[model samples]
Target: MPYLLTGAQGQAGRRLLSYVVSLPLPNTDAQLLAAVLAIRAARGGVGNVTGTDLSTLRLEDARAAAAALRGLGWQIDGVLFDGDPTAAVAVTIPDLARETGHPLPVGEKLRSRVSGWVARTLTAKPVKKLPPAARLAGLFLAAHGTCDSAGQIPADLPEACRAALPDLLAKGFLAELSQDRYRLDEAVRHLSGVRPPTGGQATRPGAVPSSWPQFNADAWARWKSEATPALRRHVEAVEHCALCALPVDRVAQAFMVAPRPMVIAKATMGAYGKWKGLHPDRGSLAAEFTVAFRAEHGHGPSYYQLTSGLGWGLDRSLGAYVVTRLVKNEWLVTTGAVPWTLRPGPAAQAQGIALPKARTEAPGDVPAAV
Candidate 1:
């Protein structure tokens, strides 16, 4: 309930669920649930799931649900049933990996929000103990409903889900249920997928305010015109990134500013002392993530983006420390103080990990390979 979606976010979430339901996989509620989670977590067509995620579903047969996913050509590595319950298992869904015609084409932050929404809605008090069919039905209805609580059953609602409608109504998850029409109860309107009206003004979620001082279009254009080919390519990558879609001013400012030396605080070092113990393979993991991240986004990730994408769950200070350590160890590299330029360092390259050919070929006097 704490994860309310903005107008754009709601639409993106609805599109994601709709895309998965429309796939040719089995229409069972269990498979539907698993697919939603997998697709939401996926980046570059790969996502990680754990035994705990499966067990929390309380499905009649978790293995069977996973098997059903595999039937649709999803490659799920590792044994979900036999492994350590907390170990992350990577699930690769080929369709999501495509650069073009991507079914769920949202940015990383939006995807994470939708994934969190699915988890929270499924586990809400009214539906957590419900059967898989009923729970899945709840998800569809909530996603299709509006801020006003009105919704029509989707045309593609699975046959099994249709039979579970009465259970949702009985459980108070639905305020009313007629043949093809239904309304979500007031208690769960936050989970509605319908975009709320913004009084006619459209808003981009992360856009910079117009008052920002550094956004000079003429200056940016002039800088690009004067920049070296390598630097120009790097600037374009940041400016044109589809995943970040950053404001022109924000992109311009980062490149316009001179690189600043990092000032490591005592607090950050203290946090790092405790944090490093939890991650034994931090160097390799950080290095590998940068490669995958650049392949999809066309630019390197910032410190926070790198840690979050890897599911390291570090706060800003600790994340900085970790990245600093990786840089020191030669497992990751950056372009001085440039934003979003974290890539594999020499150590990783020595281990057969490096940037794509196009990226590696263009190296300017930036003191790093992005």
Candidate 2:
């Protein structure tokens, strides 16, 4: 299967195209070519995407940039990020042998924190039906597309729209890929329900009430009351590794281990190619962590995420983050319910196993937007 790329007209898009073009295609390996195919496939996934307003970006300028890349043998496969599948978990690289194919290259916008409260809020049942934005904050850390770099969202929204998911979902503005997902669908912006926020409305941590933030200031105070005043709550926020600064060696391992089971995915610089999810115990994560430690300049350490970070749309706040352990065995990443893969054949998952698929949708169905 060819690589599928999505969001061809956003910040990462043009830059990615430019970078790929700069590379000498012929000398590239088969695996490299497969990665390109995966990117192309992502482009094909797009449908009724709400084109970013790009207030100052002239259409002609974009065309010129696109044309220049076209001259460089850059071929986009399909549309991706249909709505807001900010929850995608890995860099869909196919584990292809000489005979098999590879998966798409879906880079995640990594987040540093691991806690269980958030996952229950978004992925748990009885509440899985909650609106998409409830789980939106961390979308960027999960599966950011080209649009993420530009920070370009729909314009023409009211001044009060602190968060306007409803409006965007209405007029078929952005295709509703799934419950915890979204795709840009600007054609029906006017009909969208995402509205502006009103007076005194807080978008801060614990705003959702149903998820992790439920234990806001007062609750948080209660939980850590017994601990040292200074360390009342030190739910590891972020970390940096100095080893990454050195030239990387191929001897690398990835994993997920800790309080809970999570998909440990990180994009290391000069490390093992792209991102890899390592499971603890099941895998050699401790040593991997050591390597990660040695691979950095102790600055901008790779994001070692542990928590699943699912919940009501937002992934902001120190509490929302959870540290997790790497999986010790071979693992696969999924979206909603499917094992994200690069196999070109059928998407029909295993028989006894059923997963949620992105259903085509309209925006008005989204809560908060109205």
Candidate 3:
């Protein structure tokens, strides 16, 4: 029977290959090999099969590879092997394709964000003023009063995450769980609380996270320290700008998913986001826009991002403030910068400014006003 093995490393896997190659008589353990290999695949990614251990994988594209393997008659095993104290290899199997084949498979390794919305809201809905992340952050300020939890989110995150907890709770953006874990609610997504970044931040734990890089401890910590409170202020401090009916400018800014905002460029174009200019009434008319479609439509729409276009160098007028909607609830793309440092209120105020007005859908499309 086939028996799968996994986690056996470089030299060790080669050694095992040698042993199996030299075995004069065939000893079948295909069942065992297949089970172990299957488990390893489920937990990890696609891997290279060599002797009795699995090594190097690209799990991102698993389905196609699985089909390939099934055609080869390999089942999986649920066992593991250790080459030594700090090293080891993994394995999988079904049965030998050939009773007598020379050598074994070698190893091959490989590896391998948001939006604009509003205006064409589809529905001629009445727009209401709302505070964005700034207000959310401000509420945090009111409760905490100061940036006490600087330097990092407490090592005991359950306790420290609380520092920014109140703001989320108040906004109804986050839900507290009976299991003691916290989760962002649908409302929490695209919240002004999240800050899109442009990379260059520390990439380690305890260092500031970069908007562009994947989320890490250091970046997350920096946000927990620097921006949590300010973000609160940014969100809460809003009043009016008829042109941009949202309560605050903070609400006007849509985050450009930080992790990888560029992918949407080729994927989604011609998507209109918010528009605006300096207006009377409020010093700056900034409003938030929504870009939503029925998820029931089968394949959901991808949010086109427009954040990086707004920075210092790449600050093409169209690129900067012109962002698209991101609906998938990507945390790193949205909030990578928020935990680190909030751009002071005055500064943030000037940032996400835009025009705001009710969407003009067809007459019949109008919903009964409350």
Candidate 4:
């Protein structure tokens, strides 16, 4: 499992990732890799401590990345947010783990925050009178503060949640501060268990709190007059650790604790040695073929004469597997079938190759121009 740090280019996000990665964990679990995956679109950086950089992914690409992890039976430990958390909480790492019965990493650093979010969410009252979307909007406002100083909704908020902002503020979870802007009340903030930085300083006692610059006098009066705020559920619990309830195996896997290399080497030789031969200076057989095919024929080689052409005595399945890998890596593109044809894909084009006509594409099937 990996920890995702969002707004990763920001100072807070970078600091949090740095701190989280430095914490020590038990060295016998492979469930957690001791690296952090940081994401940001502006610079298109996604990398882990291992120094593997998958560059320039769109923000929406994070979902695909997470899904790929899940397919491998790994789950995200948590997401450290350095941006608006309104949408972040909806896909909260803890919540996703709980929903899917996957293990969630619970480092001492994040346990308190996770528990707090769980407690707050489980106890939050729904605005029964409002539609479902509006109710969630109300909940988000109550949990996170109103829009930022510019009165703009957090860019990270889901569209549906953004649509509910107007109705939520009408009820005072958010008090109108200025034209199209708002401020969350102390009551809502308290229930959410989040305190904004006071005076642009960390949330410390004695720090002056940020004031609502355009607080509506009538709205404040109406808010104070309400008999019970009536907006939140008056519920509380002992807040036992959510991780404690898991079975022993599940609990053991919760934190992305990684095993030492020696211990891993003992478990399975191949698993530990998988990365031993990946020399950056050399290419694999598939890569060599991809390059050769693109240079010679301006496309991927067909498996029709795999044994002789590949010089590896590969059978159809093995040959197909190799081709599949090339396709997956974007080295080859299948143009058509009948005899099956392949063309140089984006990876080849990226290499500055000016593709020419390939005799291998079948004489009649060949296009007028290369």
Model 3 ranges off by over 4 Å: 1-313, 318-370
Query: For candidate 4, what is the lDDT?
Result: 0.33
307-370: candidate 3 lDDT, tens digit per residue: 2111101233333223222212111122233211111123112343211222444453321110
What is the lDDT of every predicted structure here?
0.71, 0.24, 0.24, 0.33
Question: Measured by TM-score, how close is model 2 to the native structure?
Answer: 0.22
- In model 2, which regions exceed 4 Å deviation? 1-40, 43-58, 61-63, 71-73, 76-219, 225-326, 330-370
**How far is 29's C-alpha from truth in model 2 (Å)?**
31
Query: Candidate 3 lDDT (Cα, whole model)?
Result: 0.24
* Selected candidate, larger TM-score, 1 vs 3: 1
lDDT of 2 at 284: 25
* Cα lDDT tens digits for candidate 2, 166-261: 544443334553444455343322211112112323211222222232224554334445433322211111111111111111101111111233
- C-alpha TM-scores of all predictions: 0.54, 0.22, 0.17, 0.26
Residue 336 accuracy (lDDT) in model 2: 17
lDDT of 2 at 198: 23
Segments of candidate 1 deviating more than 4 angstroms: 1-3, 198-370
User: Largest TM-score belongs to which candidate?
Assistant: 1
lDDT of 4 by residue, 46-135 (tens): 222111111111122444444444444434433422333332221222222331111221222233333233224223443435543454
* Model 1 error, position 172 (Å): 1.4
